[model samples]
Target: MRNIFTKLCVAATIGAAALVAAPAAHAVGVTAADTHPEQATFTTAPAGEVSIQAAGDGTPAGAIQWYKNHLGSTGWQGLCEKAAENSYGVTGVWASANAHWNGASPKHTTGTPPAGSFVYWNISAYGHVGIADGSGGFYATSVGGAIGHGSSVSYFNNYRGWTPAAVPHQ
Candidate 1:
């Protein structure tokens, strides 16, 4: 009986030690703001206009990659438009007017946008656009003074809303 009791105590001590040493479990579906505090300090502009670059190949993943690749690029006045056009094929559309793209039939909403959705803001006459990260975060131009990511839509002034990608993903 004493031997059995000793074994159980040892097992309990080991279990307690393991629990103390275990890393904290991260919350599922946590927003960027929750994980990245620096993203909360995003900067905004009325237009964030730089210069137009090449349009993307009309894929949400590609658009996201394009934004990630150009993280520190400046002079991209059309970065927002370019990102949306790459994924949605809505060329020649302003950031604010992308919702009306012909035949796209976008469903605009003022709530949290899904990943790969096109987010918009009423920043300037042209407005602003960005790609959603699905978890209440977005990747866009003029964040922290260049192409970058932000934690929340509130980081930008006058958030207009969001519209899903032109093509539905399964």
Candidate 2:
């Protein structure tokens, strides 16, 4: 027991030192005024075709990766409240729990969606929304389910329209 305690202390000391020596990599898609204190850091912009340099956030390529990330997460299902929060403060319900957008709203579009577009739906009372994977497919979260992916047919079936966001990323 004594030896194990000593080893644990040594490991903790080394971990702390490593953290202190390492540079802080800031979270993407987060702005000061819009930031959630205890939530996550994200950016809402066109950071190339990949987020984190991989397809970039808010891009078609990035949406695919984001879809995968969401699918792999647990307890992140539903929380429709955080849909926009997860999209770096874009591409989801704006000031309301509805799948609607306007010309003045960020990431608003109509007709067919291009790859990496923000997808919206008007299903039932409130709607659902997600990001386009740029492959005639989209990824969205259900009211109480984890992120899911499907064909464009599924998207258009409930489509209110699409919105292409080309704003500045933080």
Candidate 3:
């Protein structure tokens, strides 16, 4: 038993090192172009404008800001409005899927960023935001606010699979 544990520890160290050396890029089933129709005109919301809400108010700006604020604070600086244009196609899709949050898309319990995982991407029309709780069911916060805003960390996905995105900071 001790030997097995020792081997597992060594393997874990190597796995962690590999992840650090060659971080895995965020890849979902959907493509960036297919996800956001207005990807060309999208951008990150302003800092002061960003807010956390508990529902979708239709206004893109509010929801965008809320998501950015809640998605944790790591590698989420210098976020611009136009950043979502070509930067985060799937990011926008994920936000949209979450907006509905009706078990529409595909989601998994075994694969997710983690509870405090931070994902870097520009949500279409909304702008850049991070991942709060990465799991089968997670919740995101932004400035414009949305259906799941102001909630005590709701699951982003309800078993619906995750969409594709360029998650720079996974």
Candidate 4:
């Protein structure tokens, strides 16, 4: 196990080095035309985890489900407004997802992001965020256009890690 771990570590280091050496920019997935609101489709096999809830009333999972259903149909601004967003896209998504949290307090989670875990990428001043579909990809706005495959995004750099803004109200 130790030898295997060491090999994996070495491979990861080499991969990182290659990325640093690459020229130009590296996008996560193929984008349509560099526009606002995208609907990304994942190439990776879906992660077998049903994290998002169908009747979410304000939680990370609910928000993800909402995005998954409304992305291409509603668009980013529309979805943000629907999620009761009063801020930027990323912030609005997080707000909407966790708005109905009935827990002690909303907190961000770290480490390996599980399904329903809100994910983010430090792209710009506001950054971009979404919920993991348990799959490698996520359901988020500003991808191809609508909330969809996160890995299928064009700018997959500047990973700011992930967090949980809220859990389901129970």
Candidate 5:
């Protein structure tokens, strides 16, 4: 009986140690913000004025990749990494989520969009990319060489029958 009791105690001790030694959730690539944080918020802009870089601009294949490469001088790889799965096609809810998720802040703005936030450009045929400022606006660079802060242009305006969907990444 004593030997059995000892074995049980040893097992309990090992279990406790393993729990303590384990790293945080983020260490395993699961973010606490995704679950603990409240529902995310997005800004409303007149769809016509927003200007995000489009996928047709001879850049990357996805909007998330574009944001990853051109969010800022430092670039937004970490945020891009976090938002990697959020990248869908050129115009979808995932793309919208990319624009809305401006880091942890409620407002990623052009002058100060979150490091990982997406910058959208408004254009025809395709859109553009920029750093998403949590605010209603973003800082975008256009293919025609127009670079500045502006609101996220809806994908609906890009084509004849493409109604833009709110991105799920948010």
Candidate 6:
């Protein structure tokens, strides 16, 4: 009985030591490829504005192209509006419902903004905006602590919605 107890104590000590030496688990960041449009809940834009499903280029390849070119860039810290303006060539890309670009009013929606669309969030007085990668993810400033790609619109607070790529209205 004495020998068996000694062995059991030794085993328990080894197990405890292993547990203490184990490394802590870290959180994995979500990528654009990991998201799906079907997983999102749809919502309509506010009154007088166009619906994301109703106007603009449903697929703004340019946005994606721009995102790819600027991926991992940290130059866009507080320039979320400027980034959107430069990428889409639209002015007054504010955080409110009045945000418009090049005479085109933005359509809004929650969850899974279409690729190349402008994703907006109400994080500040001016608001935050990023370009969607169409894979249920977005590219924006301060993402992952810098200008980069984020896996969801929910990455920021107060998700206002998204607008299709602005096209010059006739």
Which model scores highest in TM-score?
1
For each candidate in turn, the TM-score is 0.56, 0.50, 0.22, 0.46, 0.22, 0.54
TM-score of decoy 5: 0.22
Candidate 5 per-residue lDDT, tens place, 50-162, comes to 33444223222344333333332222222222232233332333332234333223432224333324443233212334444454433333311222233433311221111
| Tens digits of per-residue lDDT for model 2, 1-170 | 99999999999999987842312232222123321222222223344533443423544565556555445333444343244334442434354325344432455445557765666655534445566656665655541134555555243234566667432132
lDDT of each: 0.57, 0.47, 0.33, 0.45, 0.33, 0.56
Off by over 4 Å in 5: 1-115, 119-122, 143-145, 151-170
List, residue by residue over 1-170, the lDDT tens digit for candidate 4: 99999999999999987842312322233244333233346332246533333425455555565555444432353232233221112232333332322221334434555666656554443445556666555666545544446543233455555555454223
User: Which candidate, 3 or 4, has the higher TM-score?
Assistant: 4
Rate residue 60 of model 2 by lDDT. Answer: 55
lDDT of 1: 0.57
The lDDT of model 3 is 0.33
Clashes of 3: 38
Candidate with more favorable, higher TM-score: 2 or 6:
6
What are the per-residue Cα lDDT tens digits for candidate 1 across 1-170? 99999999999999987842312332222223323345544333234432223224466665665565556555453445654554443445543333433233465656788877777766554566778878898877666555677888777766767878544221
| Candidate 1 accuracy as TM-score | 0.56
lDDT: the better of candidates 1 and 4: 1
Candidate 1, pairs of clashing residues: 49-77, 50-77, 51-75, 51-76, 51-77, 58-86
Rank the models by TM-score, top first. Answer: 1, 6, 2, 4, 5, 3
For candidate 3, lDDT tens digit of each residue in 1-170? Answer: 99999999999999976842311223232223322222111134467655444212233333343344434322222232212211222233334323422222233323554433233333343333333333322233232222122222222212233333323221
Highest-scoring model, lDDT: 1
How many clashes show up per model?
Answer: 6, 16, 38, 7, 29, 1
Tell me how far candidate 1 lies from the true structure as C-alpha RMSD in angstroms. Answer: 17.5
Question: Could you tell me which 10 consecutive residues in candidate 5 have the lowest summed lDDT?
Answer: 155-164
TM-score of 4: 0.46
User: What tens-digit string does per-residue lDDT give for candidate 6 at 1-170?
Assistant: 99999999999999987843312322233233433334333232345543323322223665455545555555655666555655554434453222432234556665677777777765555556777878777777666545567667766666777777663222
